[model samples]
Target: MSLSLIDAENTLASPVCALAGRAALRLALTILWHPQAQRIGEQFIAAAGSGDIDVNRFAPLFGGLAGNAQALGHRRIARDALRLRRHRDHGVSLLPPQSRMRVELNGAMLAGAPVRCTPEQVDAGLVIGLGGVVLLCVHWMDRLPQASAIAAVHGVGSAAIRVRELIRQVAATDLPVLLLGEAGSGKELAAQAIHQASARCRGPMVTVNLATLSETQAVAELFGADTGALARVGGGTLFLDKIGTAPQAVQAQLLRVLKTGEYRPVGARADQAARARLIGASDHDLHDGSFNQSLLRRLEALVVRLPPLRERRCDIGVLALHFMQAWSTRTGSAPELPLAFISQLCNYDWPGNVRQLGKVVQRALSAAQAGQPLAFDALVPGVAERTARVRLGQLSGQAVLDALEANGWLIRNAALALGVSRPSMYKLIGKHPAIRQIGQIAPAEIAAALAAHGGDTGRCAAALRTPSEALRRYLRRQAAGKLL
Candidate 1:
């Protein structure tokens, strides 16, 4: 049967081409069938092709190069061919009637032509046809590994399985995306990923931290000054980070940009210039009024919330392994993550999020270089006790006295050692009579005592621990005796 143009194009559209020249050839051939799909694909390739390359130059000559250029370039092409061969070898076929049966059937059909096959023959044919379709699908599926290997050879992450759906969704739109999460949640990374997946990936991505810029500076920074020089410098994307902390005026400036795609920088009186794209990020809750409401609404066109590390604890082990491999390759060291260390990392609440995890891994690597094991203690400092906060009210008189003696009656520093603020510490020391008495002691004598004790208070106190009350009573008695 002669193939219709629609039939030809439909079969050709199954494979998405990689080589620009080959893709153009396929499109040119398809135009004979359905001009529309071919024309659309042609225009895209024409726009992408630059310099000595054009559709006319590549279309007519692609077929002479040999067995499907795609098959030759893809790594598992041989394996796919083998699988197809195997399916053909194992595939069952419909049987033709023998000569005697053919004569009997012809005589019967002459009496009443039998147009339908027997039930067994029909069932067998249906099963074989279904098997062929399934095997053909398997052949195409097998080509996926070759494409993935090609991607790997080009230095791309093999996270395609996980990120494919998200990537596709992000690419199909030009909306302003707001990435929201806690600090170190990789909002910036997500922003770039979305930008890369979008149509504007070819453009640059400019990032500015709102927290680092003051109110006046932020306005000037986002909307360039009237001078065309600053505005003309960069034109890709304006990524605003920590949008929650951006001042009210800056938020207004950004909102204006989102509305109009234009901005006039700080100190500029010139008209606003249009921008390529706007992607914003926030480590704080902008929807909760941590940021300006109007600004949030303007950017709410597309909001992507990233879960914190604590919430996605299951991904921690995989993430940790990735980090370890990356660091090891960069530093020329062997991978050193032990199961116990990974367990602690997974169990811990990553308050700082991915940033903290990366830092811990780096620290662990450094420790390993210095002859230490890659353990949790080496990775994190003060993991058990983050900090100590004390309550002086809970201490007894004796305990208070003991603390005072331990600190040598230096109330300010003593309070620090005891983990209380300076003012509360002063109050505690002021209530002790011994502390007051120590305060009254002459500075010279105290210095002398300190020198004598070599700064050991207990030793000094044991030598001169007399009560002030007794000293006063003895002086009064001695004065009365002298008067009599």
Candidate 2:
């Protein structure tokens, strides 16, 4: 029998009735096939029960189903239905509340909403009947192609705990917001999330890279220009990235629009309608005096600064695994990420930040595809291996001498050869035992290494990549007759 209940009329009917009906259907299927249907029903019950609600009343049916592995071919159909039912209602509710959605649309003036959470965000208890079906849709959506950028630096580790709270606050407000972070820090993604949660999500979210536009063009673009100028954007949002670089004239024009919902297009003499909200992002010189103070004041309506990757080291492994899996799928190659590779990534300074990290991972994936062993050489190349080979306890003068001799005495040429500057080279060489023993790895030897690396400091540093620094310090103590 088809189960139908009055959704709007019987407002007081509890969800328990729906649960009971689903349970009855499973029991009927179990009875028809005895042990076979019983096992399938049990699996369904267990999976469903794992979620928030109690589907345990079906346990008797499940227990009956457990032992019939044979003659159970017919049970597959029954089990499939049960699995579908359970999956739809599984876990936590992932989407923002309707009220929250409404607020985002009207209060915040957001553009369109794109689902951002993973399948894990779905809530099991809040959904029933059709809600369960929508949950499956969320799972399917998650499997679709997504943006290739890494998750925000803040999305990893302990930082994630704090960020979730921040996300709540940022999403709740409709104020003009500014995101500050180093380049490739995922500021744009965060802005999207905010827009998704805000009230204007149903509208269009237009993005313009203010950094790429000329001063005159930016003005015309931001505020609709005259007859010749681009028409003003209708009800929607405008995302201005690298607004710090927006020219002074553009800033003045932009300020006018923010102050009064009016803007003229480039080369246009007349102002036009302005209904779009503004979201600005800046990675450089945001705090410097060179940026227009008025523009800063306007954008700072609400400011959120994203932390760097080095500050959130604990998330490196998780992020690396995620990226590795993603790239593996992209390359159609099953490449496993070794724990050691992740560990090495954690120790680096990450000067280029997440962008550099993505490049490193992509290169590693490419190398693994070429049938090479997954090694640190693929990421940073040479350093981890050399460090492992040298086995230096502390960085010291003698250690420098060892590496210098290994490479031949070349100083000016050598320092330039390594990614390290001349000062760092001198510092490394002076701290080692070799400085006193052979008077250092001879500047010329260092110079030769630099030359060999083609003056690419990164490459040279990789060539001399050893944990000699630690061993050098210990050696110095021993040489000075200062025993602990």
Candidate 3:
């Protein structure tokens, strides 16, 4: 039986594909990146609309060199066979001779993301993973779009898309640019993208963090006759990282260079015109009554702001996939980051942002190569403890005890409520030593252990599984209540 495809939707109508990602633009981007999926999706949609599409006529969607040609397809696909079998749910029809596309999953992989089983009913915009794997249900109402040449660059989020557009717009100009964001928030990468896309794409790009260099060193590097970094960046791009940290004196010199575009090299009598365009970066807000005003004004000619990873959690899956592939290409070892790991990654509040994510991926990669599933403890040191702290604050004492008893005092099981790891759960137990003695000892004995610790929260917390600070706060609260 052939799946129907008439009067279908225009955009990504799949709930799964629409999952929290608004930056992917059109699912067509997914198809454009992987030609095989495009070809298959297109063929299946075409045949299904014809009213007599047969599953038998088409070979397996996968296998064969033509089908695996980077796995691209959809509307323009001809050779790769895409199948659609008529799915009769409970031997019933839910339509008036209407059309619908019934998609089936064959466990096709997308980067390292897990492919979810297709639901009983498939519609438009049903995306699979960050690997550009998508299932589209085309109709007469649908329109096939062209692939964006620039969309192929780094990000797959809406914010990233805008940033890329800005880069492309400004890359042709010679104006100085300022990038503002948190550390490891892709400012440097954006700068490089700018350099590569600019008219000076053929020239060299050099980066130096002013924060890393001494005041004297930074002056020598930037203005001291354009000898070292200045000489190296000769006719290309000079990326000054952590520009806010540059000394005031150096800022003044930089301002002069920006104004005149000429600096005398060390030991050189004549001044050389600065041909390299300047790109400055800062993680902190310079306008917050801190940075040098003159320098800030000069560097504020063109600005691009980057939102942190936590702000765009939707891209975490794709970023993780990209990081893994990049590492594999660099180290020549393909390490897998399954769906479970990507889910955990999305849940985390990465204070260090993408840099931290990269480091976590590296650690996980090392463990994965050795046959270890991505462990919570590997990603975080006290995952359980940190999670439990906030949750325990909300839970009543009886609720905590009930959770402990339900888990049979299994710290890891209890930690599920705490949203933490096993190690953190154990720490939670220390905060309430009575929890550790549950089922093994009587209530009287638990009190005796607490008393024997000399009301020392640290000792009692260790025996109990509580934070010493928390116990101290509790005692102070008790004392205040008594006075009241």
Error of 1 at 215 (Å): 1.5
Best by lDDT: 3
Q: What is the lDDT of residue 139 in candidate 2?
A: 16
Candidate 1 lDDT score relative to the true structure: 0.45
Candidate 3 per-residue lDDT over residues 1-484, each given as its tens digit: 2212312232322222244342211212122122222232222222112222222212223211123322232333334233322222101011111122222221122211111111111221222222223332211212222122343344444455556667777687899999999998889888998898888888899998999888888878876653577777878999999999998877876787789987777678888788889999999989976677877887888998987876555355556667777788998976655644554565565668888888998888888888877786656777556545654565555545544543333343344433344565555565664554334445465466579988655456556654444445556776899899
> Which scores greater on lDDT, model 1 or model 3?
3
TM-score comparison, 2 vs 3, better candidate = 3
lDDT (CA) for every model shown? 0.45, 0.46, 0.54
Tens-place lDDT digits, model 2, residues 316-381: 444555566678678676564453454356444465667777788888777766777766665676
Weakest lDDT window of 10 consecutive positions for candidate 1: 134-143
Where model 1 places Cα greater than 4 Å from the true spot, the runs are 1-164, 226-235, 386-484
In order of lDDT, best first, we have: 3, 2, 1
Model 1 agreement with the true structure over 152-240: per-residue lDDT tens digits: 11111112222333434654677777877789877787777766666676777778888898876776666655533226435456577
Candidate 2 global TM-score? 0.48
lDDT of candidate 2 vs native?
0.46
- How many clashes in each structure? 10, 66, 37
